[model samples]
Target: MSWTDGPFMGFDTETTGVNTATDRIVTAACVEWRNGQTRERTWLADPGIPIPKQAQDVHGISTEYAKENGRPLDEVVIEVAKVLETCAHAQVPVVIYNACFDLPLLNNHLVRLGQPTLGERVDFLPVIDPLVLDRALDRYRKGKRTLGALADFYQVRGEDNLHDALVDVRQTIAVLRAICTAYPQLGEMDLRQLQEYQRGQHRQWAEHFNQFLLSKGRSADVNEEWLV
Candidate 1:
């Protein structure tokens, strides 16, 4: 059986804003499908800051709600990092939708809290990012590449809501399985090769996107790394 037939983990986060460096994590989730068994952990964090309405609209977690019921950010991040470390140490591939956003955001928070960053924690964790995979495999496919769109294209079941970390993480795995089913070539590659492929693919996309940004006179630097 392929690695896909064994175990994998899904991780996602909902934060105060898009600025991964400064924004706070409001909620997070880690889901594991191991030996065909599903285990999930979810956390809500007070974050100690006001959550922008725009961000709150996306995930439905309000600052007031979080303050009332959520755990402190430092404590929350500690536990979340442990879960991530344990899974990745086991070499279980982590399925993250837009790894660039979530992973950096998680890492930044960890660093600020004086905890070990992902790079300091693991050698190299195999990550399956469906968004990166889709763009790599089919660069010319025209429509939206959001998780919901990919789920619809692959006929994967999506959650009723899009931004909830748990729902999004679960759907990400479903879409990955669908991608592997449709593209056997992907599954044939081992984890190292797959991550290398994603790195090359990310480089390709970054170059392309950089040019597009330059054309429009926009200049936000895109990180070239695929995984942390």
Candidate 2:
């Protein structure tokens, strides 16, 4: 069977800010799809820091509310890591919209909490990132490539509740399935080949984008790593 037909897990995070290295996770969700069934798990964390107004505006999780209603940050991070590790051990692909940002951020959180990092726990392989796949497959598609835009472009359901971790995870899975339908070649690839393809594609795109930035007299800041 195609890897696309096998068990896969979708992951997403809503954070306190855009600085993945420093920002804390305010919310996270994982949706596991297998054998035509789906199981979802979600977390809301205190983050142990103030959730900036701008970030709260995007996700509607205010600092005050999170402090009152959320679980401990360490507990949330540990549980999320365990879930991802479980999927990794089971050889399930984790479908993340942008693996680069979320995975590193979660790893940072694990370090901060004095826990084993994801790489140490399990081989961080066979990750399926719809964002990288779409950019590589479509190449020159104009306009925004945000999750909401992809949902609209792919005609996936559940576009209304974006920025919520669980909703975004669901939308990401739908977008990935839509992408596979549009590009059957992806379904033909084994998980390792697909992951390597994305690594190369993301590197090429980053180099091109960096060159564009340098041409426009801006700093070339795009990361070339697929899952850093």
Candidate 3:
């Protein structure tokens, strides 16, 4: 069956900040979407560090709350990696809103915990990123493309309570499904073809964005890969 037929794993993370390399994960979610139903698992990690006020405000996960209710970072990291790897090897396309951020963040945490990264467990697994796909498909659509915005624009049926990992993942899956329903061309390609296509598409956008930055007299260095 095609990946869109359902059983896609939608993954998302809420971290301390935008620096995936240094920021710690405060919460993570993996939601399996199949035929309009969902099976989800979530992780909340204490991170063993301060959660910036800005990050806490966005996700509503305060440092004190995390410390009180969350699990050890090492334990959560290992479990999340295990679930993601299982999904990948099971051929469930990992659906993400902005994969470039979340996947790398997960990997960085895994490394810090001395655990295998997701790639170490699964090889070239299929990834479906709605952010990359939307940019490639609707390059001229002028507006924010955040999870909440996309959820609204796509008319996805769900509460778009972004910043919370589980809510974001569920909404991300909804937007993806809506995209498939609206654009048959996207659904025509199999999972591997879709992944390969996004690689090129993401490079094109990165180059364009780089030029835009340079035009503003800023550094134009940006990773051009879609998948981390």
Candidate 4:
């Protein structure tokens, strides 16, 4: 596939909490950039549970508001998965900041509702994580490791608001482009090759990060295995 023949779908989600099995998705946003153009979409779902004050503060969607205004969780999840699966079939990578979190959370949501989970085939098609790429590219950099900070470091803009999934997805594209500019070698690689490169980079990042923590006299949490 041509590297630029996108339908590169970038995805992000806002949820009740970070626990994939327990928490539910409250909102999600996706951007489908196809053949150099883009279409954006967002979904807000009732989550079927109270959105805690702390979680609501992050994404600005409360439980009562969701109950009144949001669509059913199943409907939202199905559409989101379908949109992503379509893009993947077109040889597009669903660019996410942390696919490990968002993809699994979405799958768990489906499983919880007695629906089919988004299988590995639905997930592994050329996925990209700007967070892991940034960590890999700048392994020795100090300070914050957030999406916004990476945007700043790469000189990629439009990350003033992060909790909004749609907005974050656009910024993620900018971050990817910036990384390509910073590391010209990446521009030569096709989608599948790039995905493999990212997998290696993520593995190295986990090793390096864990080593840093250990050097600082801290024990790594087992729960953080996903990040590794």
Query: Which is the leading candidate under lDDT?
Result: 2
The best candidate by TM-score is: 2
Q: Estimate each model's TM-score.
A: 0.95, 0.97, 0.96, 0.88
Worst 10 residues of 2 by lDDT: 154-163
**Model 3, 37-63: lDDT tens per residue?**
889899999989999999988999999
lDDT of residue 158 for candidate 4: 80
Question: Per-residue lDDT tens digits of candidate 2, residues 46-134?
Answer: 99999999998999999999999999999999999999898888889999998898999999999988899999998655699999999
Runs in model 3 with CA error above 4 Å? Answer: none
lDDT of 4: 0.80
TM-score-based ranking: 2, 3, 1, 4
Model 1, runs deviating above 4 Å: none
Name the better of 1 and 4 by lDDT: 1
- For candidate 2, what is the TM-score? 0.97
- At residue 187, candidate 3 shows an lDDT of 74
Q: Could you give candidate 1's per-residue lDDT for residues 4-27 as a string of tens digits?
A: 675888999999999988999999
* Deviation from truth (RMSD, Å), model 4: 2.5
Candidates ranked by lDDT, best first? 2, 1, 3, 4
* Residue-level error in angstroms, candidate 3, position 146: 1.0
Backbone clash count, each prediction separately: 0, 0, 0, 0
